[model samples]
Target chain A: MADHEIVIAGFGGQGLLFAGKVLAYAGLLEGRELSWLPSYGPEMRGGTANCNVILSDTPVGSPIVQHPNVLVVMNAPSLDKYEPLVAPGGKIFVDSTLVTRKVERTDVDVFYVPATQMAADRGMHDLANMVLLGTVLRETGCVGEETIDEALRHVIPARKAHLFDANKAAIEAGKGYVSAA
Target chain B: MKEKVLMKGNEAIAEAAILAGCRHYFGYPITPQTEVAAYMAKKMPKIGGTFLQAESEIAAINMVYGVASTGKPSMTSSSSPGISLKCEGISYLAGADLPALIVDVQRGGPGLGGIQPSQSDYFLATRGPGHGDFHVLVFAPASVQEMADLTGRALHLAWKYRMPAMLLADGTMGQMMEPVELPEEHEAFGTDNPWAAVGTGMKRPHNIINSLELSPERLEEKNVERFERYAEIEKNECAWEEYRMEDAEICIVSYGITARISRNAIVAARAEGIKVGMIRPITLWPFPAEPLLAAADKVDSFLCVELNMGQMKDDLELAIRCRKPVDLCYRVGGMIPTSDEVLDHIRALAEGGR
Candidate 1:
């Protein structure tokens, strides 16, 4: 059975929670068992924000992932905090535009996508989270790209439907970065 | 199967309450559980229901009492500190034999503790929600689907027994999102109570809803009658799930988020050839003592995995009649124990160590 315990962490307003929600929705659309848990309280106002997302073929036992098999870090603090906690042989997707330091771990595979810079260059300023998510999908094949597109329809409200194309573009840019590397 | 949608546990409780025929919701916002009130506020108005953000938790609970007296399903939700404020109102609802749903998405406690998850309110919900020799039916949900399913069941059982019911959840349960198939919209069960304080219209004696009985003998009688109904509920309404217990020697007793965490440990322990299983109590007030007591005869020992400092461990010992050793594995003050920690405990027990 496939079980992907993913943790996404970044500073507040970086859309980490929204990215986690999209991944959770994609898992749900595929009829897989999943759980999404966000860190709440004062930290969400302006400090670091993180969410634990699990997509499993079996029933999810605990929503809290202590050692995530897949980690996505969008900032230096997030990378510093979660890089060591990734399971051996697991995958790490880093937002290289915001995080300056190199990953010190050698037991896991790491992908550095300039998500924020790519988003800015493509005029998808706040969609860096989605770009990082796209790198995760490209490297891991955790969920299909078409499934993520369907998930966006469910997550982005009808009032904000105009940003769907931009979000998609950011994701494609993320995948393109990984391919070019 | 009905279509499933991803929803937070708190939102599931709100939508499930509406499906259970609850049209009145009164609550004050609190972290980890504010989504419940927010969801109700958004949906209730469109459904022509009453959604009032009361000035205080006390007022919100009293609103529930008022609507409940009219034989309509009503609900209120709060976190730990806010739940403390509603204790007096909950006691009043119990004294008046009112049926209402109260949700407590607990945070750390003693006084205004952190807004993170904790199971420290087990004693608060089970022992005495307020100053009274009374019991409110308590249901603990471990998943978002159970959060929705048990919300409907809690309201039904509360009205069936003419008492208040509480959904005892934690911050993690409230904040976590999972797929759930909500209950269908149906007529509210057990709403046609003869003792409702609806208008008499000059047809019969007016039904008065009051908890004030001046005479000591009558008050004692009321308490005795309530106990009799509680005894019946204990006999008929104990709900629990026994996982991999057919030949298990080590029994893990837990509920809510801790139960989910324990399941992971149990699965890992089983892989290591340790015969560990779990008995998760769904109805905490009823305690599900029958299953625990029965397991005592078969299992070598019991391990309680909880988010509090051995709160449920005492109940486990009482339920098992102290027949076997019951160890406590817990974390408190808004901290949650990882499956690795719980697995270490199980491993120790399997190795004949404390």
Candidate 2:
């Protein structure tokens, strides 16, 4: 099987790194080789945050993905920065509510999900990241949805356990958007 | 007892050290490596272990000296600049024939350079961490799992050889997350070595744990004994990994995070019909010279990749005895070389561009 190199980018508070962690956990739950590398610095809060997630059948090298096969941009800046870097035939998932600009790349499949607006509509304000993640999973089928559900249990700290249901709803809404598209 | 959990490399090192029976941890906070000290700080108190954030790196290493003298496993963690400050203490540990673990979660630097990931301290780690006729066993863990596994192994080696051992990692590994199968925890603060300074009483003579020897002859003897132990370690403890090397013409030599990058580069090179492979040195102190030399015999050329200005390139040349052309592809300070850049180098060498 071909390896999956994914780049998740957004503002720090958008749970970009947490989304990557959930994806990586899903891969691990399936007993696949995976790595998660986050852009770590003092500006981790309200700053540009990004992470690379590689899920492969073989050993992964260089957890820093330069030209990711899959890119999830949760904000305008993330979309502007990473859209061009996605591989020619790669897939990109954008949060359309915040990123009003259209994707310019015609070579790749682009899914414009209003992740934040949809999450807020469902009264799950903090799960925009999971909505985008669900859309990516639906498009790529990198890991099963059940695996992601199982992964959520691990990534969400016990103190935040109450958010699991809303997070799951956001993910389902995302998949629903993709199917509707 | 095989259970896997997602963990950061720095935290894994702390957990591994605890599992290896280490009870004393002394360290000052440094970026890229602070998690190590933090993990110990949180867990040690509950386990009845000692975790003291020393005033400085020098004090931390000396605390290691004091604990190691008791023959109980002790550790100290730091980054590049902090490790530099602990050099005097390291040399003292070496001269005193003490066993302890020192972890350098390396960051960019000659002096307070950057907190970003870097392997620029290769010379300090493998060549000379301190002044003197001495060497510390250096283990370069390429993954979070290895970060944990190697720390445990390093503690065992330090105790067995009565020498200081180092886990030479970088900021990337420390920060990255991966699934790791943790080892079972051992009883903390336990040591059976007869030389411990616990107490002599009527059973044996008092044990002296001092590095200072006034007489030249006595110091020379001590140095010779340490060198002999080093030779034995060289024979028995050199560790390395070979990937897709059976039919390759070019060999890429790397360690730690750079090795991880090379693995991807090699796969890309193979996809492009470039017959390239890699040899990752797991143990940097023993240097994996034998395996490197063996690879040198089969491969046409060798390319050494690192996050430094080509420190391991020299070791590659020395190991191969300058038999083949050994070239270098490197990034200095905190920048990481992309897989494409490394593959470009491999492609150039494959096409005889040299």
TM-score for each model? 0.98, 0.96
In angstroms, give how far residue B181 of model 2 lies from its true place. 1.4
The 10-residue segment of model 1 chain B with minimum total lDDT is B185-194
Q: Which regions in candidate 1 have their CA more than 4 angstroms from the true location? A: A179-181
Chain B, candidate 1: TM-score: 0.98
Best candidate according to lDDT: 1
> Where does the lowest 10-residue lDDT sum fall in candidate 2 chain A?
A172-181
Q: Tell me each candidate's RMSD, in Å, in order.
A: 1.2, 2.0
Docking class of 2: medium
- Model 2 Cα lDDT, one tens digit per residue, B1-354: 586788899999999999988989999999999999999999999999999999999999999999999889999999999999999999999988899999999999888999899999999989758999899999999999999989999998998898899999999999999889998776433358887888887788899889999999998998998899999999999999999998989999999999999998998899989898888999999998988888888989999999998888898899999999988889888999999899989988988944
**Clashing pairs in model 1?**
none
lDDT (Cα atoms) of all candidates against the true structure: 0.92, 0.90
Q: What is the lDDT of residue B299 in candidate 1?
A: 94
Q: Cα miss at B6, model 2 (Å)? A: 1.3
